[model samples]
Target: MHTAEELLKLQPVVMKQLQMIFEKDRVGHAYIFEGGKGTGTEEMMLFFVQLLLCENPKNNVPCGTCRSCQRIKSGNHPNFHQVYPEGQFIKVDAIEKLLNEMSKTGLEAGRKIYVIHSAERLNVKSANTLLKFLEEPEGIVTAIFVTQNINAILPTIRSRCQHIKFREIQRDVMVKTLVDSGITQSMAATVSMMTSDLEEAFSLAKDDAFALSRKTVLKLVEATFKNVHEAMLVVHEDWLPLFKEREQVEMALDLLLFAFRDIVAVKANPEAMCTYPDLVPTWKDAALHTTFNKLSAQLQAILNARKQLQSNMNKTLMMEQLMLNLQEGKSFV
Candidate 1:
């Protein structure tokens, strides 16, 4: 089986592209594997690289029995180099250094491959350095750029590479994956609405308190609100320096919307099923009605905050106010 087979299923187009690369032996020198997060683009790149380097390649997969496959599997493949953000952005010197590393003679494997997890993180200086390398890859060197936002790459870089668009795994595929991960079929269907990633599902599925808190609000159906402050604290103090505040806020709203959706559902029909079925009993009709206006206002507020963030607003204050409004009893706040 291909790498990431367990977590994601590819569309026919993507599979066809894989087969073409294997058969033609004309793997492009540069490629942009673009898709949403958890859609398995990164895993697909690694699998494809393995297929290219596999000595005893089979059915478009690298046969682990062979030495080449063994080396790649063991992370000892001399020809494979992956570069990612050591901090936040890929610096010019870092990429320059990676390019220099690629130029070296390798102990094994015919093709030298470099996988950049977030190609968008390349700052101007680093991007310019990469442009020079892409202008000329002298040998069987392949660079796979994985991105959720393909437009972030320069036009010069975009025009030079083969662009492969990847979509989300279908509902059925997501459900089956969740089931295989020991989730009941009903829960799988419920959580798949948010996302199908196993790691996410597992956490959400297990957190009954999180679900109830979300029902206290209305848009997203199963998102829990219990750990908002805690989660935000970690993101602010620990991850803010690493990931953009825009991303963290988006995640926060995702949780809020999901929770509020359950609140709406419970308000309208108490008997109806909710994403957080386990959290249903905690819901109160009075609370739901009182919170309705606040929920709508917060939706626009989060959107406005997101806009201000683009204009360089203070993220900590934006989040602090947003969370405070969301946490209070809908009427009193």
Candidate 2:
């Protein structure tokens, strides 16, 4: 439950714009919050709504202790409505029903706020219906459309709303956030690159499967240079069982690539960033044994394996071949 100020820290410009709107008493009825998944658009929307509904708001900040704020945080406020896609798309019926609800007067003496999650999920018919509602702005009604793909939304809908874009969190900020949350610096750096969502990165850091997969990948990397047979055995017995899904496999490959890059980084400059900083001794040893050419070849092999995986290649076979190539220190080129 992030306060409006905390969520605004991620998007200072958007917060400034919102403050200007609120201070001028010119808050619009329709707004399009364009951002990637986990980019805090939903948080910003909720915060804005709280400001609008809070009885004791000051400088566009909601009093978290207020009844309206509490209800909004718990998602039980009478004037606050949310619409989600039924399956693949937001059906027309959902929009029609929402419009019907919005037609009524406010039950809480504040703005009637409706949030549409994944607005692009609305089908053509539903989108057209929403367009009609946006065209005729009702009394004290605010509609927030949140979507990752702004281009997928209808042009007419886009034209009717005030657009606010949320940018991806910066890597340094994300790393610090994860580190502050008790994740190791090495894992924080790796997970930050894997996801733009701070919460998802934190969740991945705490996931047992992700932790095991990372350990197994690092172990396989060490075994590849020390004993190829041991590396192959680990992939078959440990890595494969834990990472059967395509997404998991890809993530493991990404970890392997990062490991090789770390070796190169160590060789180039001892002070360079290392993804596996906790395994600096191991990386330093690998750097001492392997030349830049060998490390580059290994990286190329892992990248090639990634492309093959996307082509629906057999997972076990791909891993085995990748392990062999990495052990052989040979270039796919």
Candidate 3:
């Protein structure tokens, strides 16, 4: 269980609202915490649950030493239930089991709080089953549904819950958090732009494989102007082999876009911040060798390749074609 102070620090406005709700004893039976991944929604939910179950909460803050708090912290709170998706979807059986558990008396003398993560993954049958429970809440129950995609949830389910939107962490804050976590500034800036989630961006920055992939993209860019054959070789040997999955390929393409953007930045404004500040020397060299028009055209080509990738084209062939286009500086338009 996280401290209320920490939650407030992470999201002051949202937490303050929740604190007000708790302070006024206006806590609702159902709430929907909506936010993207890495927005601290899960952590905030856990903290709120602890606040609800804490025996001695002061100013809506959980006393960390209480037995109830200890049980929550240890993940053995009898009244606290959490439901996660099974495979791709939360099936009916899971909801039924949770409803059964919630229907019974609370093990402790307080509210029975159940958090459903990825609530959007509830299948139709399961959502209907949950709707019944929501329609007739029993035994001081509080239901919290957490989801990244609010639209994916049933409208009926959404209607019964109070929606609390969690905003994405600011880019500068995310970068600073990553830097504080020991990631290099250049990598942190790049990864933070790629994802809003502080933890995910930090993880990506520290991933050796992703780091190598970015370097390989830079290498391919360098090879394209000097030696087309070498660029093709990079695609076959390094790019294709390294990015076997579609998602990895998409990330690699994103890195390539970053590299080109850095090249453009080097030519247009040397003082401008770059996603790859550490590679400014290399970017300068590339910028000197290529014209602004060519770089712009190449950026378009990369975007076109991304579109082709989404069309479910053959991955290997699509990448091969993309490499060839980049080597030739061919504009898709």
Point to the candidate with the largest TM-score: 2
Q: Score each candidate by Cα lDDT.
A: 0.67, 0.85, 0.85
Over 4 Å off in model 3, which ranges? 1-12, 58-60, 85-100, 103-106, 121-133, 136-139, 223-249, 265-273, 281-292, 307-333
Model 2: pairs clashing at backbone N, Cα or C within 3 Å = none
* TM-score leaderboard ranking: 2, 3, 1
Query: What is the per-residue lDDT of model 3 for residues 252-271, given as tens digits with 9 covering 90 to 100?
Result: 89988988999999999887
Alpha carbon lDDT at 114, candidate 1? 87
Model 1 Cα lDDT, one tens digit per residue, 76-134: 77888888876889877789888888887654546788888798887878878888788
Pairs of colliding residues, candidate 3: none
Our tally of clashes for model 2 stands at: 0
lDDT of 2 by residue, 1-333 (tens): 676656766777888888788879998989999989778888888888888888898877888889998898888988989999999999999999988877876466657889999898888899888886777766678889999988998887778888999989878778887887799898898788778898899999888878888899888887887777898898888888888888888898998899999899999999876777788888898789888988888999999999999999999888888888887888554
TM-scores of the models, in the order given: 0.64, 0.86, 0.79
> How well does model 1 score by local distance difference test?
0.67
